[model samples]
Target: MASPSNYSSAPVSEFLLICFPNYQSWQHWLYLPLSLLFLLAMGANATLLITIRLEASLHEPMYYLLSILSLLDMVLCLTVIPKVLAIFWFDLRAISFFACFLQMYIMDCFLPMESCTFMIMAYDRYVAICHPLRYPSIITNQFVAKTSVFIVIRNAFLPAPIPILSVWLCYCGKNVIENCICANLSVSRLSCDNFTLNRIYQFVAGWTLLGSDFVLIFISYIFILRAVLKFKAERAAVKALSTCGSHFILILFFSTILLVVVLTNVARKKVPMDILILLNVLHHLIPPASNPIVYGVRTKEIKQGIQKLLRRGM
Candidate 1:
């Protein structure tokens, strides 16, 4: 570890976020679309949360979990996108080192928490479908409340070291970050101090959080499939699979885009930096944008609840 004097000696005070360094002319035009997406994400998620909270009919364990998901989606979008839009719209790229790490920590913690939340939801669906009789005991209100706390604490503290350790590193090099968001490696690479620990911890912590979540989610689906197949009739299997369809589709998009971002990041030398960065940014936005539309709007129960709420409004 570097000494305190080593960190204090650095002259840099803030980081300049160079968003879309490649696109010179039309990057400003990106403001409207990105802003629109952010508004839509916030609106959709906020509406879902309100609908879930106010309506007595949605006071079930599943809706509670869906509410948690919506809250996370709204948080993830709010945490990252506003700063990005600032960069695009007003050229307010200068963010304090303190703010940078704060952003890093929030994004790091919440993104993984969302991933874990998806895994938790998968298990919830599995129990609800595969073992309906035991669903009550398996996933009670108490369980969801306790598990929500665990998810936040586990994800927040597990990756806390990544940014905490990062702040200690001496950043005497260029203060310009290549990416829009305060991404871990993007900011870390600017440090003059030894960053091997940061890199190693990132790899280990990332796989531990993301890898384990993906593995368990996959296992949940496997069990779901097995349970559905053992129904002793084709129609039953279809019905079972159909019940999981919305969740499956949502998780599929979430995992696929994330996997693509990871792969492209690993093979980044062969790809355009803009594309890799776009994937990174979109990974934050797309799932949140789709959540309320897919889960709240298309979901029959949520849809009916919304219509009921609307009718009551009229």
Candidate 2:
């Protein structure tokens, strides 16, 4: 038999990923709760989507945009959760090349799309609250449909180049990703080949899309604030603000999580990598999990609709 030292020193395969630093100490304590959250998020998000689609009361532009947001959250949860649960429950951490790429692709794609949706929702609020008289004409059904189509087209096309450029850069032979799931940065960092262009592309793409969307959202809200100030009634302004509150909170949380991960990940030291990774996963997973319930349970109309649906079903 081979010596114990020799066996202990065996080289790890390039693609055999052991994500956690203390893999041996890994337990399934978080798995059950995470799995439950995953199901809850998916169900709530999907139910919201179905509610908006089926309800004639929710046929307006605001509701249409909300429906789209619900769908985006549902997609985001679906893309990340199954793999996460699988990794925890079954110890199935190794993902193939194509699957990893696809996961990363979906993540990058949806993130920006969701940002766009938030921006559009901001504009909707601007029209509704800031320009109530003109809102009906400006946010017409046809225009809303067109905006929805534009969001879809932009989302599908925008992140296409990131994946292509990413895959083209040589990953050396070392394919072990450090995170629980394949992220663009984690995957790119494994490459032994020249990735200056790849890194530049990722930074530029991330900053450009994320920055632009955030700026637009801020600007829209600025005008909204000015308009709300003009309203003499304090309750009127509060009501208007409440309409956009959940989306704004969700956007702030998501963007902050993203900025923290992106800024920390590329730092010279690797000390913060594990923490950053955990935060990154939590950001992506939790919003999708909590958003629907947050918006649904908190909003009286949605709560009533859900109650009605459940009652009718029974």
Candidate 3:
């Protein structure tokens, strides 16, 4: 433990991100796969954005929501992956204080934004299936525009205090971050001062934002399921299920991985550090990589739009 007297020394201006120190010799092997995922996330989301923009028929609320998701995924990938790759490929692990905090802020903000997006998407499906007539009125392009603004503002401002609180801590002793990213917990733990406030805020804010979104999404899906079950025609039921199946799969993937990471962290002593670190890295990369591909393969409208775009290019 660092002495109380040492806490008064100069605060750290930079942090050394020791990414996967236990597997240092073999960690370089991760570079290729992570890089590929980064490229895939960028390319696939770009394609989705272009397809949605060019296809006049796709200028609707659902596709607009998808475009928002793609935009979020793209920004997330851009923010984290490049620096991660630089660290792996060039052995550049030093992150300046401001940059580290900025990364933490963005990660904290955008993750909840993604959760809120999934909740909005669930509501969109619920309206379409449960109140088909009202959906047209309720889920208009204007409504989606407003929802987009809400998501940005809610997520941006709500989590702003996390990184800000972390910045106020005095990190005078150790500047080495164990994980690849500047996660709030990892960064704040190094502080010389009592970081109980930081930890409490992080826990309360994170669970509150994500937990509320999850509950709403669950309620929306329950209604959707009931409406689908009430369908008289077998074809109508199947069609409704097909429409929601893609979104459900994505929600499952995103939420399940997150749950596992959280549980493992709670039982940290039992779980290997390398495994936890790898899970965190994968949580960031895999969803962005898979989200577009899942929609492209499963959604008929997006598939056709991609085909049309390709044909036009050729």
Candidate 4:
């Protein structure tokens, strides 16, 4: 007979399994690479934020936005990676209700905020390229600060209803979450109740905010490309494109990976699911690591400022 301690007599509240199955063996080597990547990403993004804030020379609109982006990326990483690493390290499968809710909310907050920030950055580029003469007047420091505040407030409150509503939904049935993380999709799928409204909200948010943001981003880049082509000097065109190159690359990479994951998951691709999920973790972590380095490499102002900071330290 099994001991009472060994069995969950509480009707087995929930069974969350992140691993694929018994036949699929776990890879220990994957953890080493992942940990290295996580540390490097966190370090690079943090360094970028510090370098920009500490260096007086980086006090420009572009670098200011870059600093904000780095901060957001850090938030993004914190929301997902730490819990993931913990789960891997300790082989923990279950999370408390409050902890799960907090994780969901934080992830929700960062996702929308990051998208909004990118849209704002697009507007910044639009102003700089489209109306250089009025750029200063249009995108005033006050306006940027206000917009940043709005980004936080908008996401912080808007996503509150989502997790709250979901948590309250009936889960009296089997509570086995098949994903690596406590994803909204998996949670909603677990519920025995009608999740039509939840699906509607997900679709609307994905298509409207996320989808529209991407569209607007492309439009801004289109105009930017036009502006670049019109530049009389070769150097001017190269410089203008270079200013946006790193960000555009990162955006494209992330968007492509995200879209692939969504489609594959929706289609129920079993074999690639875990691998894609792992890649999603990398996708979240890589931006922070690469963002700062991209700016540091591309922008003279940031480069000079970082150099100055290092000199002072030495």
Candidate 5:
């Protein structure tokens, strides 16, 4: 008989997503919740986008960033969740190579874009609260437009080679991807060819993009805290604290989930594979789900816009 490495001479045109827990009949129960999360996320984000677009009063730097965040959250949800629900509900896991690469590209690219967005939002807050007078000049319409273009270009180009590298890899062995979505490692691990480089590159690229963003955001918050503390007026200080609360809570959730994922990935041997799989799925879904509820609905202007829209409907 041929050696183990020799078994995969035929090409891999598709990958089978094994999905979480691997519970055949029981997995059907998961469809309702997953669909609900998708619906909630998409509906909320779309509503926020529409509110921002229709309201001229919301056409400012802060609301513009929120608009971008809402858009990103919607795109992020669409990229990974629908196929996942299909896999869970219908057991339709087989994804063609081109489609898989496209999914991988969107997954990799959009996440870093999310990180960039949070960082940019932090900076916007810093400028607005710390230097109110100069805020209008500093964080202008042109600045927001430029930053949006930069975020798109940076993330689109930087993580692009990752999916391309995966596409080029020869998957000669079993083509089963043991995850809900086509993640970089889950798919590359199936390659008969060694994928050591892919893992290392992804690790480095992930940390570099997300890590730097986190550090910068932390620094921005530090300055924000300092500025808030310097204000002698208690009411002003309280306003600043309240203003940052919702945004920070959402950011904290985003950061905490990502941190857990990193810790769990590093400790994969000790943790159950199913748990790891669940964490991976939740990492993509939770933040998107949290976006509209945590940030959009909580924002005063968005709530006002919603009320206005409802009144108009009446």
Candidate 6:
């Protein structure tokens, strides 16, 4: 319905990320805490990866899957946090057009990849608990390798169209993104052209990818819970539950924050824009920071691995 003449002929070369304009006066105070969170996420995941790599006793399918998760978390933190800290600390918020799309693409791919990894980890636990005998064969190193490949291909290739589609949309002058990072929706909405298709694809792709993973994870946990309940020995049941406790906590926090962000956005009238933006930013940080700590504290092998690494370092 809008005429082509109404839109500017010049292309948008860059975008300004307006990170929480409502709190501009005091936003610099966020620098210390956000920098700390970023460091914690990077350090924790790095330590977990190192501990797993150095501990040969941990060279199993479960720990391999955990290593994959740690890698994803670290990559995700690295991709999003540094730019965010730049915005908070030095007021550097300009992102080139290509870089913005690249960030959007990476976030699109990695967020769902992380979800898929969690689902695979859930499946690993389900097999370990429900069919311990078959776990050795069913969840072999080969299985992890295959699943890792599948996760990479499925997540990376399927979401490739999101940013591509966004690129086709004409941005006729408005180049300000309201969020900290180049989130898909935040960046897409800036286009002067009609972006309904972009919105539709993003919604469909996101729900189809993340929604199905969540469902499969839920089913896996249900089976795990059923299997744990059936164990005749109380100690066996407790051990089984303990094995899943950390994973359960991690997924719970991840899904809960994601769900809250989605709900707040859907009901944006009631939620303040600053709060919504804060939630989106924290969602990226909190999970990565907590994941390694939860697993290290709850899983004896990882705890011991970390301890061994610490002792060797000291």
* CA lDDT, candidate 2, residue 293: 74
- Lowest summed lDDT window (length 10), candidate 6: 1-10
Which residues of candidate 3, in runs, are more than 4 Å off? 1-10
lDDT of 5 at 39: 89
Per-model TM-score, in order, reads 0.94, 0.89, 0.96, 0.89, 0.95, 0.95
List, residue by residue over 127-208, the lDDT tens digit for candidate 2: 8888889989999888878988887787777677777776886664565677777777677777766767767777787777
* Candidate 5 colliding pairs: none
Residue lDDT tens for model 1, 70-171: 888888898899998988888787899889999899988988998888899999989987899999999989999988998999998999999988898888
Pairs with backbone N, CA or C atoms under 3 Å apart (clashes), candidate 2? none
Candidate 6: TM-score? 0.95
Per-prediction backbone clash count: 0, 0, 0, 0, 0, 0
Lowest summed lDDT window (length 10), candidate 1: 1-10
Better candidate by TM-score, 3 or 5? 3
Query: How high is the lDDT of residue 44 in model 2?
Result: 80
lDDT of 3 by residue, 184-297 (tens): 988999987888988889889989999999999999999998998999999999999999899999999999998998999888899998888888888888999999999999
Candidate 4 vs. true structure, TM-score? 0.89
Superposed on all Cα atoms, model 2 deviates from the true structure by an RMSD in Å of 3.7
**lDDT for each of the candidates?**
0.86, 0.75, 0.90, 0.73, 0.84, 0.89
Q: Any idea what lDDT model 4 has?
A: 0.73
Q: What residue pairs clash in candidate 6, if any at all?
A: none
lDDT string, candidate 5, 112-197, tens digits = 99999999999988987898899889999999999999999988988887888888888876777778888898888888788888
